[model samples]
Target: MSWIRFGRCLVAALLLLGAAGVGSAAVAPLTPDKKVERGGELTASREEFHLVVAKLLKDQGFLDKNNTFKKGTKMHRLFESYLQETLSDPAVMDFLYTSLKENAEHVTDFDAFGKALAGEYAVRGLTRLSESDFQELLRVMNVLADRLPVRDCAGMLRPGSAFDYHWLELLPLDDARVYLRLTKQALVAEITRSPRIAANTKEQTSVAYQALYAEIRRRLAPEKLERFGKIWGKPEAAGDEELCWGYRVLLSGILDLPVEPRRWMLREYANLLRPPQ
Candidate 1:
């Protein structure tokens, strides 16, 4: 017979909402009593949980349509060049590198990134559940899982529902698909409705893309400049500040759309600059 155990501990929640900014907050860890016997539970450390959550929230549904590329449109060309340049930025690369390093340093099964960054060192306990308790946990988790937003945070610029999907998925379950959809929808609604969301989206997009472009130029070959285009040129001359800002806002709103939309936009833009066969 399978057994069930029910225990309540504080769940840590330390979510970063945007790019290249540092937030200092200590999260309390949930130390489970002991591992329950009879079933397998994948233990994840803090960094693992943080990374998982970050990936979940990185979907495209979070933005508005204006930020995304329209097929066969001039906007698509601008987007492609802008994106390549942005990705090439040094600061952005540093941010990505830092995030990755932090993730790697703290990915222990015993603790989450929340604990690791906080500099807490200790192997906490994990309570084992009876089969029945496990089922109940699953039930609760399922209900919460089903609540995940399916849309992208494109417009919201905050780590919303899709963001939660990461931590939630860590729990053993069968309702991942259902939860993921809901999370996207929830995020879309939340981001689209807020008046301030647009501003936030613009700010984040500027920071992320600008950093990316800066890094690209710093690291890549000058011969490759043609590929990125004169995007490296002054933004004022190319009307980039205005165009790019609008693009980011749009991308945040529709990040959940088929990656193809953005992908096609980028490809088309690239081909236009240097005719492709």
Candidate 2:
């Protein structure tokens, strides 16, 4: 059977037992209604995506433990299933197949396949790229960016380690700190306006943000400090553009906040990050 079907079956089984209560012997699954009302279900789940994937790779012994490592198990199976389904998708397979067919004579290595795909997107315009394409693009980015593992860079030494959750290496500590300080305040205001989130949950988020920020501050470097300043202070400066984008994407993923507002915030911050050239 298909991976998607399998995943749904798993969820269905959990939901069934959850509904039956099983004489208090079974733990109930969080209901969809509750998840919608609380907001944490989706936010937390989405935030865990990378962390889960990281753990999966480590647990499966996919990486060289000495050089590249991860700590967590939650992301492993979920991400594996996601990749399986992604590859199984006919459109993605077709894209890969067609690209391979077109470049068969000249291109060979796995890297060449990736570059061809990226080139195809570039020619088509980013607007034309589908969600699958975007997902694939991010996979390529992870390979290219080689972002320091949360364990190594963030000072998370153990499994399930995360800033606001645990302590490890602290490489990005300072960056997380300053950004969270600004973002938590903005989110509180937004939530207050919408009332979609409970006041307690917002407070919890504040605590999470505060803890994360403190952790990040400890890891700041001189160049990163400068970059942070330029991005946060002078949004109009060209130097801040790239920095702002990095901050917006990374922190949004880390914090489980909407990227649209964060992107706007980054744009605004960019103006203050540096003087006009």
Candidate 3:
């Protein structure tokens, strides 16, 4: 699962279901379908790559202009599943940890690494890492490298407290957003569709959600003290007892659950989530 090709596969599988391992989902290279020849090199342009992503989002009705499924849209389970499965799969974690470890050990100069990578292909393509993104990636990897793998998915928070999804193994800064979107959008859709659901619950869910996002922004960054504005476009207001949990039901207070905690995030999110196997 070279970082070189991760996003390419993620987009190609934009519509694929069942499997979502970057390790197995590897694609031809960095970006999308538009092939261009530049100085005898073949690679997709960022413009073309973004175009592909835009179309995929449109066709699938997955994300809104805000880059979230805030319109009550849920893409296929595959996008969210990528994070879910990757975070839960021991094999995937092993591959990721090893890659990040090597990158950290060998690539002291991220800019130099990017420069070297750029020349490897006759041309470069989509999801190709720019020096900035690569630097950010390394920074993220640094944080990840220091933490115990699986991100303590089983212990993200105290038994009585809450956890942030951003700390989850799915690279919360990136794809975990999709997981949140899918999980929430699905919950919203279900509430509307289910006669078994309560209406005030949606209002409560909304309050919790806003509070959750605020807290998510607060806890996830170096500038945790910001009172307003956004971090990565997520609100940094603050949270309350209506704890906003993530990753899955296990951290959703499973042990505290009166029913079998097998999986029951807002009623098991039965349609959207499953306990990590």
Winner by lDDT: 2
Candidate 2, 111-217: lDDT as tens digits: 33443342333222321223233223223322222344422322221223222211112224343232222222222222223221112243443443344333334
> Each model's TM-score, in the order given?
0.18, 0.27, 0.18
| C-alpha RMSD between model 3 and the true structure | 20.9
What lDDT is reached at residue 47 by model 3? 45
TM-score top scorer:
2
Provide the overall lDDT of each model, using Cα atoms, as 2-decimal numbers. 0.29, 0.31, 0.29
Question: What residue pairs are clashing in model 3?
Answer: 30-126, 31-126, 41-122, 264-268, 265-268
Pitting candidate 2 against candidate 3, the one with the higher lDDT is 2
Candidate 1's error at 161, in angstroms? 9.4
How many angstroms is residue 58 displaced in model 2 relative to the true structure, after the best TM-score fit? Answer: 22
- lDDT tens digits, residues 6-111, model 1? 0000000101121101111112222222321113343444345444434423433321122234556434444333333332333323333343344543445433
The global Cα lDDT (0 to 1) of model 1 is 0.29
Find the number of clashing residue pairs for candidate 3.
5
Model 2, CA-based lDDT: 0.31
**Candidate 2 Cα misplacement greater than 4 A, ranges:** 1-74, 110-112, 115-277
